[model samples]
Target chain A: MNQNKNALLLLTGISLFMAACGTSKTGLITIQEQGSFAVGGKVIASPGTFDPYKPTPAGQTFHGDHAYVFYQIPPKARKYPLVMWHGIGQFSKTWETTPDGREGYQNIFLRRGFGVYVLDQPRRGNAGRSTAAGTINPTPDEQQWFGTFRVGIWPNYFEGVQFARDTATLNQYFRSMVPNVGPIDIGVTTDAAAALFQKIGPGVLVTHSHSGGMGWLTAIKNQNVKGIVAYEPGSGFLFPEGEVPAPIEMAGGQMAAVGVPMSQFMQLTKIPIIIYYGDFIPEKPSDNPGTDGWRARMVMARLWRDAVNRHGGDVTVVHLPEVGLKGNTHFPFSDLNNLQVADLMSKFLKDKKLD
Target chain B: MNQNKNALLLLTGISLFMAACGTSKTGLITIQEQGSFAVGGKVIASPGTFDPYKPTPAGQTFHGDHAYVFYQIPPKARKYPLVMWHGIGQFSKTWETTPDGREGYQNIFLRRGFGVYVLDQPRRGNAGRSTAAGTINPTPDEQQWFGTFRVGIWPNYFEGVQFARDTATLNQYFRSMVPNVGPIDIGVTTDAAAALFQKIGPGVLVTHSHSGGMGWLTAIKNQNVKGIVAYEPGSGFLFPEGEVPAPIEMAGGQMAAVGVPMSQFMQLTKIPIIIYYGDFIPEKPSDNPGTDGWRARMVMARLWRDAVNRHGGDVTVVHLPEVGLKGNTHFPFSDLNNLQVADLMSKFLKDKKLD
Candidate 1:
């Protein structure tokens, strides 16, 4: 009986090891535990198209798409092209429209010579902001699939994940419809870029926010990526150990969410990363097991440090106190704050001599 | 004779009009020229390859070829990818790493959760830094054919405009590479990130500084880009009208080599952009050329305002005397006096929930 037990134990250990390596496909799962935290409501589902500056054509892939906010700056140059992405909420448009009369980040990049693009993160926004809706929205197979998913703060709300995926596809397709924009598919884009490198080679790529993980993954995957200048990338998810907190921040107060594999991007990608946490210093009450932002920042920093230590490259972690921003909340990309952030980025871009 | 003269005048005017539109690739070039300037440089050629980061492996399509510092920041997840196309004698690495220390705008994103990437910039770097005895190093074009280049800055000789085609090619390649680091190119690894979005989709793109123009061109060439965030991008060489000075404090003693297409990204992409520049309130005579970074920061603040007014974002420009930094060079990301730049980016990223 004892011999049999030992053999079983050994078999289990080996099996676990194999699973860990193989599981990289779905990434590590992040589990959120309900705590004393509560928010406005359960998420609502809505089908809406949001374009800050204008509207998309009905047949356009991005048509009827809900957006947090879509904005456009007067055209600066033909060399410049439209760039857009999704924010956390189903629609990031709310953040774009600040009561403070600040210019949104969209306009900021516009004036400087960038066409702005943003999409409504599917199933997020007012759609998900339901009164009693719990933070984690479950999919049809919540029981079987809920606990096993990772990346975002919430459980694998089938719609939310679908929404994110849709955003990517739509953005890809939408770029094709826009004049002067590049091709749609990722393969085409990268292959074309690679081909271009063959003819005239090398350049830059850009990204932001939750998209940072996606962007990082994309950049590393493509050999042509030259450098990256990410702003406040959501890398906290990379760490699963230590004092884990809620995966996201709720309006009411601090919330506790399960950990997932989305955070694994940092661990997986050794590409140089610079994590930014808007200026929000925690006070005495900071240790309240509720707030997740503080913990997230620390974890991100640790992850970056570890990456740098392991890999000989430059990765920095910055705390922007001047802007007084907290993690992934309403963005300062509105108005003066937008300019401030833009200025710093501008300087960095110039200094780094990216291309 | 009078009628003939009148006819001739009308014909001349018509020809000029056609030239204005026809000569420009994009019909809106005239309007985009409203905010324009020039930063010039020679394009040093370097051998190109599918694997610029490493030696070309067997079967790589893009083997030894012409190249240049193409892009910065992978399309992963960050505000923007900023490219710093080095001036004539400057290579991508030099702009990133100065003799003094690691100084370059690329650091801005690297510290802010950005996936910063920099190329040898084709012909520029990788070409022998030392000129051959009794023979001028081949111009970028000649070098491309010969397939030779070196790394780092080649001292006083900052070449500009010698490799316009190379620049365009670099832009094209990097633009194509966008999908690699973005949601579209989900699971690939320059980093070990899984293609999470492949099951779904991609996000956004951002760029900064001199790379801003490159970003713009990349966007225009490769339309899949979702959003852009350019900071202090160089003005349009094509439209050299309302050019602004590089901040003296930021530029330090040197100004960016004249006439490179940083700001021109606006015109190229016709995309939205966010720009930022410091208002240097100069306090010393040495800072007379306020564009140079020799002035005291207090004084640099005032100068920064002018530069911003002349060249910053169309949405908003933040002139912060309080946030003013000193003893820095034109490279905004290289600010040592105040890491506020990094902090600012962090705040914005966090606000965007990118952190």
Candidate 2:
């Protein structure tokens, strides 16, 4: 072809690549802090971008966004977009670092030709809560400690109705981006994972910790999620009937006390689900060791399995002793040992790779 | 007692409890980033009222000091302070958060009544490497790729000859404070661990990785340590005969080329020793699958065991498979599903506690 014609073709290819890449809206959303606050006393987001201002309307508050550090690798063949999420108070950077200081899981994925995106939660990562007079700073250590202990993030982000709405919005975003990058059929489990799968039609779902609740909500509400790998997902059934009480969520400006009906949640969904827990339980209320919670988790798994079998749908439920799939009681994704979790996750999603 | 004397005694009791409750330090070293530089960039340290900045000399640079966040529980007693050093590019904060977002092993110790101090290495955590004036900015892709793979601050902080000197200084400081804090037996292995143990009058020397080299050096040259726990310690014998490398020194000095002789180093100390290794083989060289390295470690272990046995001392070598410790790789400390190495470490330490 002539030089001018070749240049024209090049431009067309570039445009096609950009269009095929997908639509990703990168911006900052900040949530206002309640009560009196001080300067230098805010939680700034990691990677530093999104900011939420204060004076949030009574019911319309709690707006925020998270950024994913994206890296595209070689071997331009069809592949799955790998989405990894960080635990509470941690950024997506945790998954990428090894104890010995080697490249994180993202580097491994990128090197192996997988597109990697590390997800930050709305109030987590670089998205910080707004301070008095509209400034972004990381929530105070007091708030983080409470969040770590499960009292929930101060002015909890993604709780009650806002949680469901945020879930749907995030899912829509993931689905809309799938066409540009590749396919979402690879896997989804955490809030982003389930949302991505639910948005992109059908795929696997992997849930951990509080997000385990998200998995149940998605499986019950969205038909597109085909499987689940629930890692130490928090559900009422996991606790002794009267020992650990149910999580309290507020709806319509009143506290709505509800127990996690694990068996019912499982029965509501028809898909393969794997429930994983850590064996080395810490001395804590939630982490009650010796598989105290396993019985409940098992019951949920069994009920789901039986329902699928009755309907002639294929689903498998297996216990992962070698996998520290769920973290301790806090955030499952923060476990430094998640390399094995990722390995197992990779295996679970291998056959489902997108063309 | 008189009324005034009785009141004085009560006040004294209260003061004692408060003093024993928590302890603070002065002359604490503080580290901070000069500016944004590469993750593994060479770390520079200088002394300045423990301030974050104030340059002194080229060779005197080190990372800033770190505060140990500790909790004391009852029953087991929270007196012993286990000084911890994270691997490359990591801070103590990561260890504080478990996978599922609960407190991890360090916290496990706290629950069991143990005080732990996890220190950050220089040029890591809040202190990162700064760029030279007018350095070019990396491309967006390069930032994602290179930035994601920075080394842990510890490695960058204590390296070459500076590591040995720092270890010595830290040991003396701990020894001086041990009387006030309870017992300050230094426990480290691997390069930093070994280097630290060597500088102090060692109690039990636990060395991992390149720290094994330092252990041999301490054994042959310094006779301070009481016991030894070598976890997958690299072997000097693995090198070709007559090709052993020499001791790297500061002041731009070069000495004898042959490295420390393990055979000779073994002859100096009759300390009790225990060695541990993992089972999963590495799929790649850089993957750190210590499964293969175990055999090499075992060879070294056997030599030590035989030597100790002949000398009428005690030494034990336990392979993972024999103990049912499965799915563990080279990085046993951070293994998600299996913390076999750490479990064994605690068991060994428990014995020492009794001693």
Please give the clash total of every predicted structure, in order.
221, 53
Candidate 2 docking band? incorrect
Off by over 4 Å in 1: A1-84, A90-101, A115-209, A223-226, A235-273, A283-292, A322-330, B1-26, B29-355
lDDT tens digits, residues A264-340, model 1?
Answer: 43333444444454433343334322233444544555554564445455565556563443322213243234556
Tens-digit lDDT track for model 2 on A1-355?
A: 6999999999999765433231211111010100000011112223432211111122111212212222222234234444444433334444443323333454554434454444433322222211112211111122222233232233343222111223322221111100001011112223334444443455444444445555555566565665665666544222222323333322112112234354534443455555555433322223222232334444454454565455554445545444424333232332345455556656666643421
DockQ score for model 2, please?
0.01
- Per-residue lDDT tens digits for candidate 1, residues B104-208, read 444444433354433322212221111111111111121111111211011111122111224333221111110000111101110111111121123233433
Which candidate leads in lDDT?
2
Best by TM-score: 2
List the candidates' TM-scores in order.
0.29, 0.30
